[model samples]
Target: MMYQEYVDAITPDQEAGLKRTNGRMLANTILQNPDCFSTSDRASAQTILDSINSGVQQDAVDQLHDDIEECVEDATDEYSWSNC
Candidate 1:
């Protein structure tokens, strides 16, 4: 999402961290609704990503990364790997 866009313009290490965080969020969302990941019912997921990409600002990429980390933490109760 926003985190992914921000991650895209960062260094490899940071990018890897962001990817991991994104994967965690995606996994959790999928866990809540598997169809969102493996079926044709991914409209909501796409919309979230679209919003993130469209509204994300270069100055906010770092903040977006932190936001994703928070999201992952809220989803999994763990912020270690989620803090991209």
Candidate 2:
């Protein structure tokens, strides 16, 4: 089975699983079928996996920034009490 064929064969459930793992599952899948995937195919998969990891990392960083901003705003509001 070619790499593209493997990708095309993924079911909706498998796709959801892939998304949930940030594409990490693809490494196992490719490893299990080493005889089927060529060097270029493996390289392509690695590229895709790297891209997924990069996106996930960016999302985490963005969320952290948003959380910190919210915390700072709350702290500022608390300290700005007119009674003080």
Pick the lDDT winner.
2
Residue lDDT tens for model 2, 1-84? 444555566567665445636355665567567787788867877876787778878889999999999999999999897577
What would the per-residue lDDT of candidate 1 be over residues 1-84, giving only the tens digit for each residue?
Answer: 543453354456566446545644653454466643555435655664555454455437888899999898787765554766
| Segments of candidate 1 deviating more than 4 angstroms | 1-14, 35-84
**lDDT for each candidate structure:** 0.56, 0.70
Clashing pairs in 2: none
Model 2 local distance difference test score: 0.70
Residue-level lDDT for 59 in candidate 1? 36
Query: Residue 48 in model 1: shift from native, Å?
Result: 20
TM-score to true structure, per model: 0.26, 0.65
